[model samples]
Target: MNLYPINAGNFKLDGGAMFGVVPKSLWSRTNPADSNNMIDIAARCLLVEDGNRLILIDTGMGDKQSDKFFGYYYLWGDDTIDKSLARHGFTKDDITDVFMTHLHFDHCGGSIQWNKNKTILEPAFKNARFWSNKDHWKWATQPNRREKASFLKENILPMEESGQLKFIGLPEIDLLENSELGFDVFYANGHTDKQMIPMIRFKGKTICFMADLLPTAGHLPIPFVMGYDTRPLLTLDEKEKFLNMAADNNYYLFLEHDAHNEIITVQHTEKGVRLKEIYTCNEIFN
Candidate 1:
């Protein structure tokens, strides 16, 4: 299987919310903040080319929201699925499957787009089946007050409306077998309700798509959990368990939100699990 990091775009998010209760003085060391205390973010998606199946792990926040709605996020950069796919000699139409990690806007918003007439919504990848778990689909569609803003209806709904949406069953491992996509998913609830994390085997390495579990290398210290997580304590435990396995097996963590770092590896250091090294995908695969 071949893997490519699709650069969707860059945006800024409040550093305080990202690092939870961690002091700015500490978290700022690695993830520096701008004047507004907003740290840089990348909506990096993963593209997997195996056999005839071309799969996308996630789609970044699309440009379909109203200016008033998007202004709140401070979006930046020229990256988009169309342009990024061209960089790898592909296009949105080439996609056969869109595997969403969760329905958070930033992660799955690009699944749909406005039609040419701008009269109605259409599935962005008309040919691909949009994948989401049954539980996450329900949680996002009927979102609670705490996460309502993040789970925008426009970002979803259209997939189902277009008749391309499908739900992945429980026991995450079966997803790979069922679809023949060749990657296992790790279910995490701390970040949200049953957020699926992909564990992919490629080039003699286990490359995990670190959705919100380990947002960046800075989150390696264990205490740096996100305030948005519904269950921070559960996040702590999940991180510890995942990190231990990552360290023991030397897994390559493919970060989705980290602006600078594309990939990272952690080690069981004297101070506990910490970043061992960082690398670009080319450095590891090529």
Candidate 2:
């Protein structure tokens, strides 16, 4: 099995919102903000080449939204999904599965694209089965007021409409169970419902994908939860548990939003599970 980090691109998000109550004095040191107070974030995706199956985890925001709509989040960078795939000798057609961690636009938008005529939407990965949980699917489709803006219909509906949606239910081991991976599913209600973090096993080490739970290495502290999370206290509990486990087991955390740090290892210190080391994924995989 081979895993590749797919760089969809980069975008800007408010640093305050990204790091809840954490004072600017702290987070700004690591993720320096622009004059507008927005920090750069990576729309990083993961590609897994497992035998005959080519699975992609999280598609970055696609280029289908109107300029007005996209004006809100300033997308930048030269690296695109196409170029990133080409870097690894693959293409959209080669993806057999799209495992979405959640349905926020930045996570799943790249799964579909505008058709040739630019009149309608079509599956971006023409031949892949898009995977999302049934419960989260319903929640995202019929989004609540707080999260409605983030769950855009253009980024979601096309998957089910295209007849390529698959559900990874609760109990299936080989299909979607937490035990198959080195880490267990520590579902948190804070950052949208049922946000699944894949506790991955790698070469005698365990690494986890910190989707929005810990967006960046700067967010390692327990209370630095994002304001976007529905239930902040629930997020605190989830982080406390997960980070403790990660420190105890020496898990390497893969950050989705951090522009600088690719992977971080944490150690149990007097201050808590503070970051032990920051290294690029290549340093580990190679």
Candidate 3:
């Protein structure tokens, strides 16, 4: 199996929101904020090529939103899914599956796009089967007021409307071994209900797609949960369990929202699991 780090785009988010109640003095040290108190973020999607399946794990926020809508996020950089795919000698049409970690706009927005003449919304990858769990599908479709803004209808709905949406059945426990996608998935509820974190075995190492469960290296601290998380206390418990397991097993964390740090490995320290090392996508994936 081959893996590619597909950078959909870069944008800035408020540091306070990203780090929750963590003081700026600490989070800013690792994720330095700009003058506007916004920190850099990457929509770093992952592309998996295994045998007959070319699967894309998460599509960054698509370009379909209006300028006014995007301005709030302070979008930066020229990277697009098309350009990133082309870098690996592929394209949108080449994707056979799009496994969304969750339905948050930043993670799955690129799955759908505006049709020519801007009259209709359509699936961006015509050949890909969009993947989401039944639980998350329901949660996102019927979003609560706390997360309503992040779950945009335009960014979703079209996959089901196009008759290409598929659901992965959840396991009775937190971990599902050897899923149909050809990897183990760790289901997380703190970030969002049934957020699927793919645990992929690549080149003799475990590469975990650390979605919002651990957005950046700065969030390695157990209590450094994102404000966006509905259940912060649940997040703390989930992080403690996951981080300890990650440290003990030496898992390579593939960070999706960390613009600066692509992959990180944590180790047990006096302060708990702290960042042991940082690697760029090239260093690990190549």
Candidate 4:
């Protein structure tokens, strides 16, 4: 199997929101904020090419939203799914599956796009089957007030409307081994309900797509949960368990939201799990 790190786009998010109650003095050291108190964030999606199936993990925020809506996020960079795919000699139409970690706008927004003339919303990847679990599908479609803003209808419904939406059955336990997408899926609930973190084995290494469960290397500490998480206490527990397992097993964490650090391996230190080494996508994936 071959893997590619797809750069969808980059944007800025408030450091306070990204790091939760963690003091700026602490988080700013690793994820230094700009003058506006915003930190750089990348919509670093992952592409898996196994046999005939080309699966895209997330699509980043699409370009369909209005300028006013996007201005709030301080969008930056020239990266787009199209350009990134072309870099690998592929295109959106070449994708067979779009396995969303969760339905948060930044993770799944690029799955749908505006039609020509802006008449109606449509599936951005015409040939791809959009993937999400039943639990998350329900949670995103019927979002609570706390997360309503992040679950946009324009970014989701079109997949089902296009008759290309598929659901991955939730595992009875925390992890599902060898899923339909040909990888183990570790279910995480603290970030959002039923967030599926893909554990892919390639080139004799385990590469885990660390969605919001561990957004950046700075979040390696168990208590450094994102403010956006609905259940911060649960996130602490999940991170502690996952980080320990990653450290013990020497898993290569593929960070999706970390603009600076692409991949990292953690080790158990006196201060608990801490970043052991940072690697650019080229260093690991290539």
Model 4: lDDT of residue 223? 80
TM-score, predicted candidate 3 vs. hidden true structure: 0.99
Q: How high is each candidate's TM-score?
A: 0.96, 0.94, 0.99, 0.99
lDDT of 1 at 237: 93
Please list the residue runs of candidate 3 whose C-alpha ends up more than 4 Å from where it truly belongs after superposition: none
* Reference-based lDDT, residue 87, model 1: 91
Count of clashing pairs, candidate 2? 0
Q: Write the per-residue lDDT of candidate 4 for residues 44-149, one digit (tens) a residue.
A: 9999999999999999999999999999999998999999999999999999999999999999999999889899999999999999989999999999999999
- Tens-place lDDT per residue, model 2, 1-286, is 6778899989999999998888999889888999999999998887877668887888889888889977988888888899999999999999998888899998999999999999999999999999887888999999999999999998899999999998766644312444322234545568998877776666777767788888998888898888899899989998888899889988888888888899999999998989999989788665
Instruction: Rate residue 38 of model 4 by lDDT.
Output: 99
Q: After superposition, which runs of candidate 4 have C-alpha atoms over 4 Å from their true positions?
A: none
Q: What is the lDDT of residue 199 in candidate 2?
A: 65
Worst 10 residues of 3 by lDDT: 175-184
The residue pairs in collision within model 3 are none
TM-score quality measure for candidate 1 = 0.96
Ten-residue region with minimum lDDT total, candidate 2:
174-183
Better of 1 and 2 by lDDT: 1
Native-structure RMSD, model 3: 0.7
Per residue, candidate 3 scores C-alpha lDDT tens digits across 251-274 of 999999999899999999999999
